[model samples]
Target: MTKKTPSLISSEFFEPAKASEQVAPKETALEIVARLEKSLVGRNPANQQSPRPPTRVQIPLWSEDHRPVLHDLVRSALFTCGQRDARMDLKAKPIYALEHIKITYTGEELRQRDYDVYLQILHLSRGATVDNRQEWVEFEARSLIKMLGWTQNSRSLVELRETIRRLTACALEVTRSRTKSSVPVVYGGPLLLKYAGAQEGGFDEVTFWKVQINSEVAAQLKPGDYTRIDWQIRTKLSPLEKWLHAFYSTNQHPYPMKVETIHKLCGSRMAEIKFFRRAIKAALDRLTEVGFLSSWQLDDTDKVKVVRSQMLTIQDRESNNDVRT
Candidate 1:
């Protein structure tokens, strides 16, 4: 039996690195705000706009001691925390909290637009709470929001707002948890310290900063706990999803592979083949939307005749070489 290679590529492949380079590194939140303010003034020069205070949300997190840690002044900035002995690739985790998460233009027209965008930055950091699963769990967004008794909403707008609030709270709780879960400078799982000195410092005071983990402490987590870390949206591959992705990644040879041939190659039944056919068709539709693939509908006759010509070529090559006598 041949082993199948993993087909799921990293999400980084979907994002254009060139687009990131176009953005400036030194641009400040204040500068962006100024530009927006100027544009608003330019559009509405009549000086009839009413002054409304900037909108903000205050989310609360529960510390290990059952005390509420409050981020009194949340702004458009980034925050991060990490395990003391985390692997290089998985060390630092960051969260970006947006200042003007929503825009409410309340005068002649009542329109609200969500502008909240925050990203959690994960990295290796030295902290009292470094490498402690219990502490980290206490700081995760889902768990923290649950602790805060926030209600979940199904609408995208409400979900985005709720997500931002919980994430901000998670950052504070995670950072504080790091201060509480102290692992020793010597790497050991069980002997790892649970509480680091409150005075120990490395995290940045303002937003958009990084924290460091100690060299000695290893993360005290079960293998299963690795899946629960606070990261971006990741989906568990269902069996069908796996097969569809795998088939595309390996068969770089242009399509028109016969459905029967694919079934034989995968050793699948008619029902399974039908499933893959539909899956591939849907995937192709999505790829077309993202400019990755081009496709067209074929008539019944064309569909029945489509075959892998490469397979036919190989069969002919193996069968015989044309001889001119």
Candidate 2:
């Protein structure tokens, strides 16, 4: 009798271990206020206009974390946490979150793996000419796989192609607002404009693949709007840890939030809150272990308090530029 072989691609594929946090140890009263003020300004610049492009659109350093603004907001549920079902791809789903935001995701039920692929595509686009038509950032598949930290193999390559297709096929409709009176801004569109491999053959036969960043989403990647994820630390976390990392990364100083609320916000599939609560502590612990978090814990009231370790936040970077002026 023939037996089925177990799949090697799992969230653990990217799970490795590491540690450190950069919480500012000492801060004068002035610095505290400065950070807070900067935080508020950096909060959500959805209402602001896109900055004018320079003569040459130089791609920022690949090391910088230029995440999609919508992904950052819907992160709690944008990519489902825990192990994913192999068959659950290309399905439309609604993620319930705070009233201030509504995100409609239609396409592949993105997993953490897809998250890497989407970001990798964007990172590669930094240097490529970008537009609505998949002026896809081009590259050789083997090198791209190695960069994603995936094992180089035919299966990995196949998976990489699917990852890109998933990214290409997805559409996001995100609505965000700071307050009821303030005008709500609608943002988002297809996560990607289009994508394809070199002609004659599909991904399998193409030596170079092209992936584009939806021009609309690419605009939001302006300086203050995006978060800088520590890829080294991020690559080492579990699905839950990665989600939590993004949720917290968007907030320079995370406030106390109910574990229950987080479970809801993260769009957890775990049927019970109690199970998610238990799982959360472990995930938070992983963040702390990896230095993405300074410290975190469930308090007596059941609200989790998180302190982040950041060498410099987007606000901090802008603040330095101001001081130089």
Candidate 3:
């Protein structure tokens, strides 16, 4: 036999394969897909976009127990003096007179609208600290409308401007009687100063305003001098009801007052006492219905005794059923 080198091929390849022998299987498509999915377990999709965050709406938190001190005077019709029409050189006689004190409105007699503006100004500027007599207090037009529960519209804007004009033009005079002599105090400067610049589009608008509360008037507003009127209830009340609410709120412990006394204090224009009594009774009823009064009664002595409720301090939203006209 010839001496040949051993063949590189295995003996098994040269021999016939057994029927039970098997070779390793190739990976299927499903197996490949599952392996790829497992690799991507902790990762975010490359094409996904994140959502934008929501914007917050700003709602002002108004004080429930604080209003302007001027509310005491303006709440009543005394400032208006029951004058509906504007007068030239209108000077009202002393509308209210108490022991050693007298109050008079000069220039144009204020109307209910004028007092409304004055009250809003006082309410907005309640937090201001007067460093000097000439210090100016500023407020925004948008804030004024929102606080007064007015719609922001063209007509409302015009009316707001007109209100500012009236308030700045009106003057208040107070005369005090002393043991030996009487002193006369006057507030003659403009109550407010308005500033509105032209927009880029050449449109004129009243963006905001500045006001100076008279020093004498500001003195009366020191701590413990202001009243808390329920503005939510106030906006819905008629003129008479609003006045009664303001008047009674200022008195911490109200005493029984005669109807005649209330009528005089209210400075009502009604000619007859009987008519005034009826109107006043209606207003009181409204107040009671709104939970402002525990009870009120006219005694045999013709005196009106009012039992005030602590609702303003206790309740946040009073019933408005009686306030609706």
Query: Candidate 3, after superposition: displacement of residue 303 in Å?
Result: 2.8
Q: Which ten residues in a row have the lowest lDDT in candidate 1?
A: 106-115
TM-score for each prediction?
0.19, 0.71, 0.62
lDDT of each: 0.28, 0.67, 0.59
For 35-136, candidate 2 gives per-residue lDDT tens digits of 987787688685255865643333345454443333334344677664665535444466665666667778767777677777776777664544454344
Candidate 1 lDDT over 1-325, as tens digits, reads 9998876998767777786476557869999998988888888867556776433222222223221101211111121111122212212333222221211111111001111122121221212343222333113333332333334322432443333333322311122111235542212111112222111122211112122221122232212111111111011223222222223322223344454443433323335656756754554454444333344343453231211122223322232211110
Please report the TM-score between candidate 3 and the true structure.
0.62
lDDT of 3 by residue, 199-311 (tens): 22213356667766554465555334345566777776676677677766765456777777677666676779899888878888998888888889988877888887855
Q: Candidate 2 has what TM-score?
A: 0.71
Please tell me which predicted candidate would have the highest lDDT against the true structure.
2
Winning model by TM-score: 2
- TM-score sort, best first: 2, 3, 1
> Candidate 3 lDDT (Cα, whole model)?
0.59
Candidate 1 runs further than 4 Å off: 1-139, 143-272, 294-325
Separately for all candidates shown, the number of backbone clashes (residues 3 or more apart, or on different chains) is 28, 3, 0
Q: After superposition, how far is residue 24 of candidate 1 from its true place, in Å?
A: 85
